[model samples]
Target: MNEGLKVFLAVADERSFTRAASKLHMTQPAVSQHIRSLELDLGAHLIERNNRMIRLTRAGEIVDRHARQIVQTEEQMRRLVHDLASTIFGALHIGASYSIGEYILPVMLADFSKKHPGVDPHIEIGNTHSIASMVASRTLDVGLVEGSYSPNEVETEVLGADELILVARNGHPLVRDSFVTIAEAEKECWIVREEGSGTREFSDRFLEDHHISPERTMTFSSTQAIKEAVRSGLGISVLSALTLQMELELGVLQQIRLEGLPITRQLFIVTQPSAFQPKVVSAFSDFAKEHFSDLTQTRTPVHRTSIDET
Candidate 1:
């Protein structure tokens, strides 16, 4: 019945069933049937027809004013529904690489939750590569990672910068010289994150660029495990400065300043294109970016070399 009203309104506006049919993508007979149904429901003759032209009867003129209002109401209702879905409340599934998830996101999420208590945020931690794949598949609504993402498949914005540096157990021989040369650093054994991790990606690029290869490499699936292994004197590892804040303060692990060190990489916020983005995702993403912008301005810079060196 409502569809019949809409068709009749179209027909009335167009002043021809054939034109209305063309506009509505329906056959002329279908348009006439809709008008007939509308007329039967109203118990009035809405249109008077000649051989090739039609005019609205008095009843239709009355109905036409009301029909326009009804159509406008429907449009407003649709917009309200869309607005509620986008901004009000829903579960937000977020994916992040281990470095960002463990070291960066907890505080951000806590702050966000305080402001939007109705929104439930659940996080999945993985390597950057895996997290990017999840975003592409629509499994994760948003992603924060420290590695590169394909601009073609996923939309990315720079979140911030993460500074990478080398770490070893306190009092390791490498730190005695204040700075180790690339060739000298390569001779040491290394404990590192797995191949797909963002840290590993940076480390691999850094190594290849400088032509440094460790004598042996031990892989760990997690940042915590790598930190522990490095603390126990298994070997030195390259890690985000953000992750080593507590350890550096506690003196459990010491940074080994390498010549030309502190590789800075851009952290990224990733999502599907705007067409695919949900309301909650856009809200949170904007909130986070604004919050981090203020934070970056006020926050003291992390020393590129050892804390004591600064």
Candidate 2:
């Protein structure tokens, strides 16, 4: 029945037996046979036949809807069964934006692997917009992104809060003082994340709020590239302080507090609200919340500058 439904869907979508047969990698005779068997089982013709065109009958439309639901449910059932057997033993598909994926998730994933040796984790890294789209479309089991998502089909939870700081190479002119006003910060050249990045989105919103724009800016897709560029005195950038912890320790980069700028943003874990979540995903989500909660709680606040300081 599943196979029959698959064949039916292909034919219905293509509106041609020959095309459906090619798509399904089946002979035209086999495709026709499946449709015939389906009609026999239901005791009704499913497709309206014509020499040049094929259309779905009223019954076919209903069956097509049911077929899609059936397929989706079956896949969900398989995932659930695999999860129940031992969530720690299945593959977990996760997507994340560049900053979180590169700077934060590695430590979390490493800890997860050590704790759950049976679970295999595969990660896909992209921009926040792409990661959110993947989660909404069920292409990814889960995603970690910075900032908020507006997609109605996806559910989101805040994983942690991070501050974006204006950073520069050690001894750079911008680092002369512990704090600078937004107007002063905007006068410097900037190395910024590319568009569509959650980091970039937050940075843009913060700048717009302060009525300041960078005099010059260079865009980089990778945070590593941006960091290195800033280290080389190419320009300054606004980035999550967590990403620069090692750089700050090594004296490679210095954080510059900026007045009248809201540098804080939330990290989110997003997934399709209606999709069946595998147990592996559920367990990972729990682990992330537990570990990240402790980390965020114990962390000291970054250099704070009041908006009135400007």
Candidate 3:
């Protein structure tokens, strides 16, 4: 496939031997050699070269269509062979958003690896939008995200429910309060996840629905950083309750509830409906459903405690 389409597509699209050679990472003479060989085999003048420019002749146009179809068919065939070999031993490439990757997938993956030692897992972490795009482009076998997506090209399965909770450093002035109204919480400094993050997206919607806006906000890329910043009393943030479990248990942070904001998001597993997923991916997907389905079943209440309780 590479030899067949390499020179033809490059020359046809670029219309210049010099440019096509550069695109194909081959010398100009080498590109000309391949084209000449193709012409000899086909017995046709496929291209007209003139003054540093090239155009496809009638025969060239006819062959280009067949060349493209042949290339596509070859790709499909390769995928099929790879999938077959992967049933016994294959790699699964999974893309996940920040929260799911950091707080959830490690445990799920650990269990899956123990069960299926023959499968190799490659994980990529990004924001929801980035992961979704990667799955759509076939760069990833599947994606797990913590928000709703409306992509027509992909199929989404709801895996579980995750809730966002407002948390602050222990012993903060608000920790002793039984309830913090949205308006009152908005007056405090806030540390938030970066834009495009699933937690941040939910936080923004939570704030909007509650009719409250933070007076001061700081953004951090990782949940660990945000947790550390909030632990030191830098600010408060709305984050996944799962992300703050250790802190909550250690009395480093306290969850504060606000009125009128649901603060919950549905976790989803997204994949291209038309794409073929390898056997390893299917195994992992089944493993995920078996072990992690409980995480999505019901929303848990935020636990609260004072610094003195520690």
Candidate 4:
């Protein structure tokens, strides 16, 4: 990628000269010079300033699209060269949906880094739809997402299956029984993930299956947020078992397995089809798939000791 184009991308993504400069480790004035030079060479204005806000102009949008491709191509070329030397190096753009990113990915990344220490990871955490789109767009080398997605030019392999269940704050009266019924579960306010989330999709389907129309509901965008809400006694929510390990162990939350409900969804590894799979990408994908069970395993419930008992 051209130097000016690189600077422009940083600016475009950051949407501020000051932030872009900080990201690029360059001065704001120099960053502006690079953008100005690029615009002058192309004979068009690429950005606009209105009320101290930076917005990409029409030409800028076109440039941004093509510039990303240029950068992607350059990265591939670099990977190809490094492959000839049999070295696994360079930054890896890894994307993951919220639940996996929050609860599962750090361990995977840490394990991967132990072998390929040279591989620098850049993570993008978002919902399933967004992660799949990023993988299709080549902005992400690989993505781990739950639920279903069909982005053009991207392929997915099921890494593993995950179980979802209803949960409530520890000792909440609504779940005195180890098993809960949909009728009993439906009366309380339901907390849910955002529209595009895999968890949200499952929650919606679960409702339809049970013929539920909760009287009240709340929405949250992240797994942590939903967990916090449930912990704070805002409402009950359905969530993956993988996310409940620490909370369950600590006695902060307890599972409320619904009768006849053992809800499950496939975990996926999304990647674009390419002739040359970079060593880093292949290594991480294989590692994740092989160890998928480790991430999905549910901790066995044990007796909890209270502060008084301790």
Candidate 5:
């Protein structure tokens, strides 16, 4: 019945058996059979299949709503059982923005994996706004993001601080100076992240505040790409301090001190405001906070000039 309900929901959502089959990795005939079996068991027509698309009947509408609830309840029950048994074995879905996912999360995940070897972790990386949206929709169990999100849709906890610093090639003309003023900074070419990036949002707001509309020569979606471009002297960019560690040490890039720069923002752990959180999700969140807490305490204090919203 659970399987049938799943098939029904997929079909209902897709409005096409073929598409649902593709989504479920099943044959079209198999999907039809599952829907048929479900209708037979219920003794009512659950769906109306037209030549073009499918629509749910009145009974199907009620069934669909109840079916979703049943699936959610089943997941909750499984989580509760695992928690009561003191077992840490389950699949966890996590989403993260590029900054945290690329630079910060690997070590934390490695440590968590070692302690909870039974857990299976799946991570999806996207921009902060997109990742937060996924968490709000419950598509991901939890999300780590570097930007500001709506408080109404999801609950957020400050994970740590990220310092946005301007970086350029070591030999760039700007590097000769101790600090570049807003006027001097505006004369340089810039390589920035694409839209929807938390880092870009903060950088743009900072640039706007300083009234410096620098020429944007290149835009990249990933932090690594932006860093590589900067290294090649394509242009300067503002990036997270955590991301520039290896590049700085390797002399590939150097931070250009701007007179009023180095914006600081809080990284966040976002989750849906639901009453029930799976044990695995809850455990991972707590572990991440505890883990980063120690790392934060040991780090040297960075004097913050201004706080960016993201």
Candidate 6:
């Protein structure tokens, strides 16, 4: 009944059979069959269906709670079995913010895979906020983010500090003097990362601190897109120094020093606090925490996590 429980949970959570089927990649009829089969096995109606609406019965509510726990427990059992046999095994789902996911994670993931070949990593890259949300919802086993997250919902540990840089195309007038005044910086067109981006958060803070408001602004969801826009002389942007290494080395883009600029952001590893932390997840988190400094090529102390603690 593993599939049945999963189907029920999806239906109950989505409150729409069509949406749940699309989410699970199953047919609408198949989803209905699973629910019907579940009700028959339990001898009770699980949900009340009216037209396009669905609501769980009292029995369904209890099953929903227990089913979630059962699914989590079953995954823990599988991972534990694999760990006892091979020390580590199974897929590890990891979420990361754009900068770390693109320029940082591949390096660490490569090394982690070399040492633990049995673990397959599935990575989803997004902004810091979204990544943290997924970790809290248990969709992602672990997350590497550059922004702040809720302390009450998820456990976090500082992985490292990422340096933010102000970048413009080479020969831009703003950097002619090797430094930009607040007034000069405010006059130029600014390109920023999309809403909810950690890089954008720092950029916004910088503008607020300097009291510099731009006359024009452009927003892009992708870091690379923003970089390209900056390169083509669309507008200057604030981005992670790690993402600018190649362009800086190539003389295509230059880092500009605004007075009291160059903000630093803390990188964090976020995980859901739970009683049972699979060996695979713990091992990967430990590995990433210890090796995060390599991303910045700095020697510094690392913090530890207590996610597995009861």
TM-score of each: 0.69, 0.73, 0.70, 0.89, 0.78, 0.77
Ranking by TM-score: 4, 5, 6, 2, 3, 1
Range of the 10 consecutive residues with the lowest summed lDDT in candidate 6: 301-310
Highest-TM-score candidate: 4
Q: Which regions of candidate 4 are displaced past 4 Å?
A: 301-310
Report the C-alpha lDDT of model 4 over 213-288, residue by residue, as the tens digit.
8879999998899999999999999888778888877889977656535476899999988878987788889999
How high is the CA lDDT of each candidate model?
0.82, 0.83, 0.77, 0.86, 0.84, 0.85
lDDT of 1: 0.82
Model 5 lDDT, residue 273, Cα: 92
Report the C-alpha displacement of residue 266, candidate 3, in angstroms. 0.8
Candidate 1 is scored at a TM of 0.69
Indicate which candidate wins on lDDT: 4
Candidate 3: tens digits of C-alpha lDDT, residues 181-218: 55779789888888788888888887777678789999
lDDT per residue, candidate 5, 86-117, as tens digits? Answer: 78777777899998899878998999999899
Question: What TM-score number comes out for model 3?
Answer: 0.70
Positional deviation of residue 200's Cα in model 4 after best superposition, in angstroms: 1.2
lDDT of 4: 0.86
Which residue runs of candidate 5 sit more than 4 Å off their true CA positions? 5-73, 297-310
lDDT of 1 at 84: 71
- Compose the digit string of candidate 2's lDDT tens values, residues 158-277: 888887888889988778555676677778888888889999998888778878888888899999999999999888888887787788778889877777443778889897786557
TM-score of 2: 0.73
